[model samples]
Target: MWRPSVAGPRGYRVVENADAFDIARIRPDETAVVVGAFGPFLKALRGIGARHFVLEKDPATLRPDEMGHFRPAESYPRIVPQADVLLITGTTLVNDSLPGLIACARPEARVVLVGPTVPMLPDAFLDRRGMILGTVRVADAEALHEVLAQGGSGYHFFGKYAPRIVLAQD
Candidate 1:
């Protein structure tokens, strides 16, 4: 179960994955920055030729060939200011880094919070141009627990134990 730090009208709604989660929705002219090491995010950005930067705290998680693409978290003050779109992981919320991360975003940047841990509340998030939430709702709690216990990823549990959904502020 999750709780919100600040609450107000819930402005987000879950929808099917058809057009909602399109990473290409990002304009080709826009430069993107992903805050985590998410595989699908790279595939989507690459498909559209969006020259993007990634900031990952753990350099060990990246492949040897991919090391050049990831910047250390310490690079935020430099790299973040250049981004047109920012993709952040919801884990930032739990770790109490969300506020600082959001503060770094430029006024014109579109900030997106993604992952299962993304809060359902939309108050603080809505102040930005409406965050595109790439989240999931568990369809079977027990099955999801089992998958995690066995070291499964969202690629495994999606549609079986959890269904990936997109929520946007309206």
Candidate 2:
């Protein structure tokens, strides 16, 4: 149940991760649209040769150092349709704008929902072709908070693993 602070003057706060989601497989050379990307994930994406269109309403949330790697899109509406894959973070606050993103994706696009706040109910994203990749479990949320506080982005997970999609309920 991770909550991303609202993108406004007051800024957002850190919440829990009872429902957080994680990344699965990211194929090489995929054109990925990342919504809510922050630190290490952005670097990993770049390392994989992923061309990204980042979406963020808050200018303050953008890190000056990382800006070199990503191109900020005009808006999610304009970016989603052009991508081959959509990597989304499940923020704490409910994002009503998500459906529009789903509607805009190409039919063949692989939509992956990441972060802790993602809903467990499959119906929330199932019909939209969304899939659960994996989740990052942090031993110290405070350490993460400190990193984010200093505008230090990116995370290094020990024994990080990719998701295995099980087709049948066996």
Candidate 3:
């Protein structure tokens, strides 16, 4: 019963960064609230010199320089509403906190859910205030399986087995 046709169409757009469209919108003066201490996104925000607050439960995920911008998870309700953009980790879905986190943002806030765990469900996220989904799609399942079995992370599989794809609501 291996029915390939049973899989639905790939309706969402694939881009470089999930928030590629909104990167420019993250200006120096505007506030960005990051739910997780994801490295690349943090680097990008720092490169932009944008004023941002990172809400992370684990301080170890943040770099020494990033400690200044770190905020406790309890502060999200107060801080999220003030952000012009929100970078939420897809792991929130696994923790059952995605809905609450998404609800904390203002109606017009640019919300981006990023990480390997993010599902390719555009309508579900978009309906919940998400503007972008940053995740990886397996290009070579065998290679990906091999990488995982060897304890390799994105650094090893990305571009070879699992390519980064930013799914957008089109």
Candidate 4:
């Protein structure tokens, strides 16, 4: 039942990039290592007293002075095991990195997949535990498409085109 087909604009089937997502509910004292460049989430985590960090693949993308602590993506294996929470963009699913990333995390760690690229299905992920999907239901597909064309992410189009929703296995 879960297959990659024509699901949204630009034909992203397995994942849902064309949808919208919302602000995540995070708790204080949770240590997180984010896998993508989601500045707003990091700020929110910090605001809630969480020790949040970023891991980017391209070191050149980081502003040396502002994000000096940003670590290289290659250290995922090392960082993931020690973190209490793991934040990742849904693009990980699109790029087929979700499985390996999930495998590297401790069973108790809250591994959350954020962004519109997450699929609603939880079939392939049956083996995993403590994994959460931070996704959204598309409010306005046309508006979302327009914003996406303009390079907008959840930060730019949440209320208009998308809203945040969380999914996890009980």
Candidate 5:
């Protein structure tokens, strides 16, 4: 369960995938730095005709065509600080790299922590200057459990059992 971190009007708003992108307000000319090889995010960015840079530790995660946008993780220090918008994968938290990544972003830049691994908690990220969280919500716990038991992944449970949602800080 989640609760507001502030009193009176809500500091965050719930939204769908597209709306979350809109909240970032990324322009075609502006560059967005993505900290992972998240395919869905790449697709959405392409759909909006936005230019972006992707950083990945593994080259295999990107396709031949996507290699043009790929940057090695070590280049983050030079690349991340220039981003107008930054989208970081939640896996960075588990790897203990999230703090360094966040520190690289400009204070005025829009930062979003994205992926199913992202927690619902807003206060924690808000304190780090994260402007939004893109995560999944399990609507049917039983169905999700069944899918996991069958070795099914996001492709099987998404939309039906678990749907994408965004928590945007105000």
Candidate 6:
């Protein structure tokens, strides 16, 4: 089970069942973007048979394991209006990029922000046209670290946190 770190006044809450996330539902024709180069969510995207990804990496050389199945973008200002989903890691460092990316997303795009760093409030992204599809929480830190140290990705830890998918308020 996955749980959100910052829950309501009551207590910690599970957002989604461990088996609920079915990536096969996503159409193979839909384009998606994975911001940043690492994490479990990236692995999840890969398991869902996702292709046509847009990754952001610095000038440093990437290891073969780090690249996974994703291909690099040829240039910046990569306007992907054809994308059906945009998966992002919510961090203060990339706050400014959110609006721009949202603006570029197609009208039907479903935007997901994963990781412990994501803002707790849905209002933060409510005004945007895309749907804020919820997040995944790491319930056990020690296990998470162990998996990472062993070279594991999110797909390996999907049910570790009691993952939840929240539907943004209209």
- Model 3: what TM-score? 0.83
Arrange candidates by TM-score, descending.
Answer: 5, 1, 3, 4, 2, 6
Each model's lDDT: 0.73, 0.54, 0.75, 0.66, 0.79, 0.54
TM-score, candidate 2, is: 0.60
Clashing residue pairs in candidate 1 are none
Error of 5 at 72 (Å): 0.7
lDDT of 5 by residue, 1-170 (tens): 23333331156777653234555777887789889898877887887777888999998999887789899998999999888889889899899888888888999888988777888866677664547787788899998999999999778986778887778766
Model 6 TM-score (2 dp):
0.58
* Candidate 2 ranges beyond 4 A from true positions: 1-24, 68-74, 133-170
Off by over 4 Å in 4: 1-27, 63-66
**Candidate 6 residues 38-113, lDDT tens each?**
4455556566666646456452333465555354443324644656777766652255666666666777777665
TM-score attained by model 5 = 0.84
Worst 10 residues of 3 by lDDT: 1-10
lDDT of 2 by residue, 1-170 (tens): 23342231122122223222133356667787777755555767767777776776665666786665454544777788877877766662276666676778898887766554553334444454434433444566676667667775333322222111211010
Q: lDDT tens digits, residues 49-145, model 1? A: 8878888989887667557679997788788878888888888888787787777889888788888888655566766774777677678999899
Q: Runs in model 3 with CA error above 4 Å?
A: 1-12, 16-25, 128-130
Candidate 6 RMSD computed on C-alpha atoms after optimal superposition onto the true structure:
6.0
State, as a TM-score between 0 and 1, how close model 4 is to the true structure: 0.75
Which regions of candidate 6 deviate over 4 angstroms? 1-25, 59-76, 92-95, 136-170
* Per-residue lDDT over 13-102 for candidate 3, one digit per residue giving the tens place of the 0 to 100 score: 566522432532578887889998877778888898989899999989899999999999888889899888888888898988888888
Report the number of backbone clashes for model 1. Answer: 0
Indicate which candidate wins on TM-score.
5
Task: Give a tens-digit lDDT track for model 4, residues 10-123.
Answer: 222333332211223456766777888776666566567777668788766655542855877888888777678788888887877777788888888777787677776655
